[model samples]
Target chain A: MKKLLVLSAFAAMLASGTALADTSGKKIAFSNNYAGNSWRQAMLDSYGIVTKKAVEDKIVAAADVFTTADKEVPTQAAQVQNLILQGYDAIVINAASPDALNGAIKQACDAGIVVVSFDGIVTEPCAYRVVVDFKDMGKQEVEQMAKFQPKGGNLLEIRGLAGTSIDDAIHAGILEGVAAHPEFKIVGSVTGDWDQTTAQKAVATILPSLPDVVGIVDQGGDGYGAAQAFAAANKPRPTIIMGNRQDELKWWKEQKEKDGYKTWSASIAPGVSTLAFWVAQQVLDGRKDIPHDLLVPYLAFTQDDFEAALPKIKEGGVATHEYTQEEAIAAIKANIK
Target chain B: MTAIAPGTLPKSSPRGNAARARLLRGLLPALSLALVLIAIAWLNPRAISYFGFNLMLNLAIPIALATIAQMFVIAGNELDLSIGTFVGFVGCVTATWLRDAPLLGIAVLLGSIGAYALLGALIHLRNLPSIVVTLGMSFVWQGLAILILPKPGGKAPDWLLAIMSFKPPYVPFPIMAALIIAAVVHFGLMRTSYGVILRGSGGNAAALRRAGWSLLKTKIVLFALTGLFGVLSGMALIGITTSADANIGNGYTLLSIAGVILGGGEFVGGRVSPIGAVIGALTLALAASPLLTFMHIPPDWQVAANGAILIIVLAARVLISRRER
Candidate 1:
C-alpha cells in the first residue's frame, strides 16, 4: 500500500506538469506592497478592469492580486516566492523598498518568470521597471509656474513626504528648473506628507509668515488642500500649480469659470498599472524588444485638457487618464534601444 | 515633656515639606503644557488667536480619548499594545459599515468590546502576560481593519463631522471636548464607589482578593472600559480627518502611553489622572508638529526634536516626583 501511494503521488506530479505545458494562456499576478491609500486602490481597480478584459479576450488565463499592509519588504519577498512556486507566468510589483526584493526577484527570473516593477519600483537588474520620470514632472511643474509668473517672485515649494526618494527627486528637479530663472526665489518650504489634511494645516500655519508668495509648486496630492488653506487665511490666492487629483481638477475648473484662473496640472495616472499589465502580457507573448526600464509619461493638463477631463470624472472619483494597451505597446516599442 | 520645647519644628512631620513637594509634582503636567503654550505664542504670535488654537488643537480630541483609554488599562496594571490598532479598526467600522449598516456596525463594535473582556478573563485564568497578549492582538486588529476598509477612502458620518467641527463663540471645540472628556472620565473612574475597588485590584491584588472582591471582574470591567474609550477615540479621529485608513491610528499607541506617563500615570500603580491625561495629550498634539514648525526646524529633524521635548518635560516630571518621595 505504501509503494502504491508513492507511485500515485509521482504520477499526479507528472500529470500536473503535462497540464501546465498544455495550457496556451498565461497566468499573471500582482504583488502589491501597500493598499492603504486611494492611489493604490485606483491602481488595483485599473488592474481589475484591464485583467478582466484580457481574460475575456483569451490573452490571459488568470490574474491574481496580493497585497500586504505594513509595506514591509520581507512580507512582499515571501509573497513573490509563493507566486513563483505557484507557476505564474509573470509578476507585476509595487515594491516597498528598492533593493530588499532583489533576491526574490532574482529567484523569479531564474524560474523564467517575467517581472515588471512600477510605482515604488525595485532596483534589481532582472526586473523591468515602469515609472514616470518624477524629476521631469517637477521641472515641468516649475516651467508651468513660470508661464503664470513670467517675472519670477517668491515660490512656496510644498514638498511631499520627507526623506522619500520621490520627494528628493522631485525637489532636485524643481531646483534644476528654477536654476535658469534666478528671480524665482523659494521663500519657504514644508513637507505636506502627500496628504490633504496635513498639507492644509502646514500651509495654514506657514501662510502668515511667508512674504507675498506669487506662485506655488507642490508635489501632487496637496494642491486642493493648499488652495483651501489660502482661502481660509483670506489671503489672495496664489497660482497653485495643480496636481491631477479629481478634487484639484474640479476646483481648478470652478476657478477658471468663476475667476479666469490659469494654471497647469500634471500627474502620473493610477491607470499606469494597466500599462504595466500590458507590458507584462507583451513580454509573456514573446516580445523580446522590451526595455529593462520604461519611462511612462505623465498626463499634463492645460485649461482645455482639464475642461475635457472634468466631464468624465464621477462624483468622489479621482481624475485619471486611461493608459490604453495600444499606447502601452507603442511606448514599449518606442523606448527599445 | 517634649511639647515644652519651643522654637524648633518637628523634622519628622510628614505633612510639612513633603506635602508641598507632592503638590508640585501633581502640577507638573499642567506646568509643562503652559510652558509649551507660552513658547509657541512667543515664537508665533498668531498661535494665540482663537483660530490658531482651533487649528493647532484640531487633532487633540482623539489623542485625549486614546490616552483616557490607555489610562483604564493602566488602572488594572495592564498595558494595551493593541489600543492603537483597535482604534483603527473602530475607525474603519465607523467609516464603512457604521455608515452603511448601522445595526450591524453596532453589533460588531460591541462584539469587539466583549472580545476585550474575554481577553481579560483569559489573562486572569491562564496567567498570561497582558503585554504579550495585547501585542499579539495588535496585528489581529490591524488585519481586521484592512479587511473592513481595504483602503483609505470612507466618509465619516455627517453628525460626527458636525460635532467635531462645532465652533463655540468663546472657546474652541478641542478645549470644550477635552473638558468634557476629563470630567466624565474623572467622575466614572476616580469618584465613583466601584472605582475604588477597580483601582485597588491593581494597587494590591492579593489584598483585594482576600477582601472578597473577584479579581476577574475588575480585570474585565477595566478592559471593557478600555474598549469603550478606544472606540470613541477612533470615531473622533475619523470625524476630524473626514476619512478612514487602516493605519491612521498607528501613531496613537505610543502617544497615548506617553500622555498617561506625562500625566503621572505609573505602570504598576492604579494612580492615573483623567484631567492631566487630557492636558498631556493636548501638549503632545501641540508639540508634535506646530511647535517644530513655528521654530522653523527642518522636517527631517522635527521627529527627533519632538522626542527631545518629550524627554525634557518627562525628566522634569521625574525630578519633581523624586523630590516628593
Candidate 2:
C-alpha cells in the first residue's frame, strides 16, 4: 500500500514537469539557404555556439538547424513549412529569396510563432528583420576612398554578385557617395561574383586597359583577390578599401609592416546571427517592445585595430566582432515601440 | 591503288561542288573558333599575346577536360547529366581526402569510377533513359560531395597546384594543355582499332552485337572514360581555384552539353570530334565572360549577350550545314 502511494506521487510529478515544459522555454529552428561560402559557414557556426549557451540557460527549449545546397526557393519554403508543422515556437531564416517564402512565413505567423530573418532576408510583413544597411556600407566605403585619394582620380569598382538586391543597393549608395565627391571618376565596374579566384581573374583581365587607378572600391570578400591581381601585374599598389576577411587582414598587416601601408576595413560581422538569436530569445521572453526591422551597424576597423584583432581570428576564418546577449537585448529595448 | 584510265576521266560536275560543301560543313567549328579569335584580337590586340592568353585561358583547362568527358558519353549516344556533380564530388575528394590522405583518396576516386561503370550497365540492362538516370545520379553525387566537405574550405593538393601553375615559354599552359588533351583523346578514340567498335556501337548497336561486341561492355567503357576525364577536370579546377565547393561545378553540366553540341556533335548521331570539342569549349569560355567584359558590357547583360553569341554561331553553322544537302 505504501509502494503504490509512492508510485502515484512520482507519476503526478512527471505529469506536472511535462506540463511546465511549454511555458518554461520555446523551441526554435534556424533555416539557412546556402552553406557553400565561408561567410555562411561562420554564421552557421556562430549559431551553434550561441544556441548551445541559450539551451543550457533555459532561454530556448530546443534549437535545430537545416541548410539547403542549391539555394532553391521552393526547397527553403518546404523547409519552413516543415518547421512550422514540427511545432517550433520560432523560426529564424536566412532566406534564399526575398518574396518566395512569404506564404509559408505568413502561415507560421498565423500559428502565433515568432519569425526573425537575417542576412538574406524574407519580405513577409509578419517576420522581423535583422540586417546591416548595405547602402551605408557603400557610401562609407566611397567616402573612405575619397579620403585616401584626396586628389581625385579614376576608381575601379569591384562589385558583388550581379542582379542581387544587396549588390544594387550598394551600387546605388556608391553612386550617391560618388556624387558628393565630383573629383572621383568611376572608370569601370565588374562583378566579382563574391569569390576570390573569380575576382582575381576579372581584375587581371581588365587591368591592361585602364588608366592609372588611384583607388579601388570593392565589396567584402574580394579585396585580397584584387590585391593579388595588382601584385601579379607588378603595378604600384593602389589604395584598396579593405574587406574584413581574415586573409585580407593578414595581408594588410603584412603590408603595413613592410611598407607602412594604411587602409580601413569594414563589413557586416558574421556574428549578426548571434544577435538574431538573442533577439528571438528576447521576443519569446515577452519583450513586446522589439522593433519590426532592426538595423545593425557594420563593424569598421582601422589598420591598427585589425592588427590587434588579428590574433583573435583563426586561420582561414573571417574577421568578425562579438555581439553579446546583453547588447542585443538593450538594442531591442531601445528600439521598441 | 588502281589508276583511272585517261579515256574514262570523270567530268567536273555539281556533285564535286556538293562534296566540297560537305567538307566545308565539317570544318565549321574550326572556322568559328578562328572567327572568335579574330574578334578578340580586334577588340584587344594585347590579349593575343602569350601572357595574355595564359591569363585569359587560365580556367579553360577544366572546361576542355569536361568537354572531352562529355564527348565520351555522346560517342556512345548517351548523355551524362551527372558529369557536373560528378566533377564536384571528385573536386571535393581532391581538395580534402586527396590532399590529406593520398591512398584513401585514390581508392575512393577509383571506386567512384567503378560506380559510374555500374550505372552505365544498370541503365543499359534496364533500358532506362540516360537523361533520367544521370539526372538522378546528379543529386546523389551532389549529396555525396556535401557529405564529404560540408563547406567550401578544402585546399587543393600541392602537386596539382604546381602542375596548374607551370608557365612554359612562348606557348601558354592552357593552350598547350588544350592541344595535348585534344590530340590524346583523338588518338585514343579515333585512331585505335577498338575505337571503331566503340563508335560502331553508337552508330549501329545491332550490327556490333551481331559481330560479337558486347553492348554492355561498350557502355561501361564509355562511362568509365567519362569518369576518368571528369576526375581530371575536377582536379584541374581545384588546382586553379586552390579550393573546393560543393556547387563549384554546377554550371558544367549544361556547359559540357553545349560544348559537345557546338563541336559538331549530334544528339543521336555517332558523329563527334575531340579537337572540335576543345575548340568549342575555348570559344564558349571566351564568349562567356572575357569577350563581353572586353566589350564593356554591363555584368547584368553579359549572360544574355553570351547566349546571343552562341545562337549566332550555331545559326551560322546550320546555314552552312544546309548547303551540304
Candidate 3:
C-alpha cells in the first residue's frame, strides 16, 4: 500500500509539472488603491495586458487583481490581506494613505509577499518604493522659475493635499531648490487642494491684493482655473509656472493659440501604469520571497522637451491608447529607470 | 418652526420689555463667545495678552466666515461638503494667479462669489439632491486640483495672507465679516420681500408654489447665496493658511455643517438665526481649538467629533422641542 501511494504521488507530480515547470511559471497578484479614478484604472488595464501575455506565453502561473473604489486606506489594507491569504507571490500596491498603511504593508511582507508601491509611495522600507520623485519635480519647477526670472520674481506656490507624505516631500524638494535662488521670493502660499471652483474663488479674492505676481507653481488642472481667474481680473498672465498633467497640455495649447502665448511647463512624472508592470514583473520573478523597496525615476520637461515626452506617453498601453502591453512595457522598462 | 413663535416681538409690549428680550437674545451668543475666550485664557495665560487676543480674532475670522457660509446652506435644508474643496481651490488659485498683484487678488476673491453663485445655481438647476451632488463635485474639483498642482508648492498674495491673518485688538474682522454677511443675509431674507419668500419656500415649498411663488427660484437663490457666503469664508481661509495645497480645505466641509448645528440651527432645514449661527460657529471653533491644544485623541476623531456634536445638538433640539410641545 505504501509503495503504491508513493508511485501515485510521483505520477501526480509529473502531471502538474508539465505546466508549473516553465521558467516563467510564477503567479503574481496586483493590488491597487482605486479603480474609480482614471489613473488607477489605467494601471489596472496595463496589468491585465501584461499579465495576460505572461500567462499565455507560459511565463507566469497566474495573475490576480485587487482594487478599491476610492482612496480608502483600510479598504486597500484589507486588499493586501486578501492577496496574502490567497498565497500570492507578490503584489503591486498603490497605497491610498501613507503611514496609515504601514501595518498592513508590514503584514504582507511578513507573509513573504513582495510589495512594490507606485505613484504614491509608502515611506516605510517596504519590499520596494516605486515613485516619480516629487521632490525632483519640485526642484525642476524652481529651476525653470529661475530661468523665467532673469530678475527674481514673486512665485506663488500652490501645493497638493497637505499632511500626505506626497505633499510634504514635494514641498521639501521645492523649497530646497527655491531657497537657493535669492531672486525668487516666495510671496505667500495656501493649500488649494486641487479643486477648480475653490481655487478660482481664492484667486479672485487674492488677485485684488497681490499685484505683480509673476510666477505660479501648481497642479495642472487647477492651473487652468487660476489662469481663468487671472483673465477674469483683466490682468496679464504670470511668466513662470509649472504643471504635471498631459490632458491639461491641451488647455495650455488652446490658451496659446487663442491668446498668442502660454507659461505652462510640465515636469512629467510617469503615471501609475508604469507601477503596474514592474510590480507584476517583480511578483513573477522570484523576488516574492524577500521584501524589497524600489523608486521609479521622474523626468523634467521644458517646452521643447514636452513634445518629445508625448511620444513615450503615447506608447504606454491602455493609458496612452496606442500601445500593446508587450510593446509598451518593453519600451518603458528600456527607456526609464 | 415653533421656536419662531415665542420670539415674535409682542405688539403690546413697551420699550423696556422689547429691549430686555433683545438683550437676552443677544447675551446668549455673547456668553458663548465669552466662555470660549475664558477657556482660552485659562488654558494659556499668555494667550490672553494683547497679541493673544489679536491672534484669537485672527483665528476667529476664518472660522466665522466659514460658519456663516455654512449657516445659509443649513438654514435652507442643504449641505455643502464642498467648502473644503472650495477653500483649497480658492486659496491655490489666488496664490498662483495673484501672488504679485495684491489688488487683483482681492478682486479675484470677491469676484469668485459670483463664480460660486453661478456654480451653486447650476447645481440646483440640474435637478438633483444637494448632498450627493456637492460631495461628487468636491471629488471632481479635488481631482481637478491634483491635475492643476499635482505636487505642492505655490505662493499666496502677501497682502491677501496678511489681511486674513492679521487683526488689531478691539476689531475682529471675521466677526465683522460674518455679521455683515449675516445682517445682509438676514435682511435679504427677512425685511425684504425676497427674504420672506425664501423663508416661506424653505419651510414649505409646496405651499409657496401653491401661492403662485417660484419656490424653484427661491431655492436656487438661497443655495447661490449659501455658496457665495461659503466662498466668502474661503477667501479668509485662503489667507490664513497662506499656501496653495490640494488638501487645504479638507476638513472644512464637516466643520461648516457642525457650526450650523451647534449654534441651535436645525437639521431638517429652514430654521436660521444669525445670533444662533454665530454662537454655533464659535462653539465649534472653540471645541475644535481645545481638542488641538489639550487632547490626545486619535487624529481622525476630529471628524468624528463634528458628526457627534451634530447628533448631540440635534437630539437636544428634539428634546427641547418635545418639552415645549
RMSD list, candidates in order: 23.8, 23.8, 19.5
Taken over the whole model, the C-alpha lDDT of each candidate is 0.81, 0.80, 0.59
User: What overall lDDT, based on C-alpha atoms, would model 3 receive against the true structure?
Assistant: 0.59
The clash numbers for all candidates, in the given order, read 0, 1, 85
The TM-score each candidate achieves on chain A is 0.90, 0.91, 0.76
lDDT of 1 by residue, B95-187 (tens): 888888889989998999999899989989998999999999999999999889764557677888788878999998888889999999889
Report candidate 3's interface RMSD in Å.
15.4
Candidate 2's residue-wise lDDT over A35-72, tens digit each?
A: 77778878877788888877886767877776643454
Deviation from native of the Cα of residue B95 in model 3, angstroms: 36
Ordered from best to worst TM-score, the candidate numbers read 1, 2, 3
Q: What are the per-residue Cα lDDT tens digits for candidate 3 across A70-120?
A: 354433554555455455677776666544455456667886766777666
Question: What lDDT is reached at residue B40 by model 2?
Answer: 73
Model 2 residue B50 lDDT? Answer: 72
Q: How do these models rank on lDDT, best leading?
A: 1, 2, 3
Give interface RMSD for all predictions: 18.2, 17.9, 15.4
Off by over 4 Å in 1: A1-337, B1-15
